[model samples]
Target: MPAVCAVLAGAAACSGVPAGFERPEQPVPTPEGYVDASDPQPISEIAWRYGPAPWRTDAMGDPRIEAEMAGIPYAIEFYGCDQGQGCTDLRFVTRADLRDSDDPDKPASRQARVWQANRWNLERRFGKVSAGEEPGELILEMNATLAGGVTRQNLDAWFDWWRVALTEFQDFTAR
Candidate 1:
């Protein structure tokens, strides 16, 4: 019994790092030429608090547009926005399209605005989801044109169509 008890005590002591015997903390990554003690918790907090919600344009754009906000792409409201006028206004349009930047006068600025506006459209779509519903999964099937030369009239027409088509998705909640 004494021998068994001694072995058990030895095993227990070595089973894991005992009290206060911790390894020195490792340093976090820092930018080149940066040298200052910093806390990462605030950075993470800022991300979850200030960053765009996962259902934002980039996230929703992933995997497909149809089934916007839960499997649907909101491309239904982008009819007639062709290459000439630029597909900047449409979120479902690929990043490559925006990178073309033909309108050199304000290319970067225009692309940023285009991305932001498309995000708003995505937000509107995601907002329509019901309680405990996916935010980007509904696929919308429509014969629409994304060609450039989209005038205000064309934009308005599509808006009206989508307002009706997406009426059911209005006021959706994030699951």
Candidate 2:
């Protein structure tokens, strides 16, 4: 009995785990050069990087900015009760068509594959994806109120996700 207790205590000490308890796994660190979206600065940096974008007003008269990523154009729409409290939304239109058929109702296999690849890549980092007005357009939309207002981190993360998704989609759709 004494030998058994000594053995158990020795095992615990070596493993740094309590008796009958498992040690938790350490979290994997973020990859090097990867932007920490929650850090805030990355988002602002992206906005500055894409400066000189064309500006316009949305239907609600809110300001919007147009930019491009991976050869795809997108719009950044702002929404808020007042200028001081608004958030931004990203709208992206892909170059790929949903289908080659003339019928709008038919789903394009190639388009679907690209969309799925984009969806998988983006969803892992950002969130859910919804269909856009035109086929092949993807909207990674967020409501200011629901998202607790957009910050620089949000914009940075969106751009980062776009960069990754663009590469992924291109690879999947390559000839």
Candidate 3:
């Protein structure tokens, strides 16, 4: 889905930055996707740098589901909404210790990068971003969420939107 305005509704009435949204002293939300590179980063850094990774975004679950798409050397992650709400725990690693596999840009990696960029970009103007996890391969273990944003039967839709990006990555690396 195309990116939407970060401004939220009913969240407040203030305008132009929204009255600081609480002092900076107060810690930000976990999924806010904020972290200091100097201080060890998490796995979801991808969300921060990439901004809401995932091609086919969907809404389902208490914390929502996120999918990723990758074309061999290129990767992309699609951020999803859990139970009609956006997902929390947006974690990814900006500087990951990935293996020298035939295709370094896997779907998850691509998603992570995009997700990280997104979080970083949004947090700059909106607020602190929430992120976690160390850069590594996430076991393909999830059930497909059925209609109405139910994660009961979660599925991996990460690679769906990454085809184009991955192709670009591959094309560049191929040279």
Q: Which tens-of-lDDT digit does each residue in 61-169 have in candidate 2?
A: 5556566665655555554324422332334334444443455665555566455647655555533344455755434433222132344565566566666655554
lDDT of 1: 0.33
- What stretches of model 3 exceed 4 Å from their correct place? 1-17, 20-159
Number of backbone-clashing residue pairs for each candidate, in the order shown: 41, 0, 67
Candidate 3 clashes: the total is 67
List residue ranges in candidate 2 displaced over 4 A. Answer: 1-45, 48-52, 82-96, 100-123, 133-158, 170-175
Better candidate by lDDT, 1 or 2:
2
TM-score of each: 0.23, 0.43, 0.21
Model 1 spans > 4 angstroms off: 1-137, 141-143, 169-175
**Candidate 3, residues 119-172: lDDT per residue as tens digits?**
444543322222224453322111121222312112122222233333333342
- RMSD (CA, Å), candidate 1 to true, equals 23.6
Q: Rate the local accuracy (lDDT) of all candidates.
A: 0.33, 0.49, 0.31
- Model 1 TM: 0.23
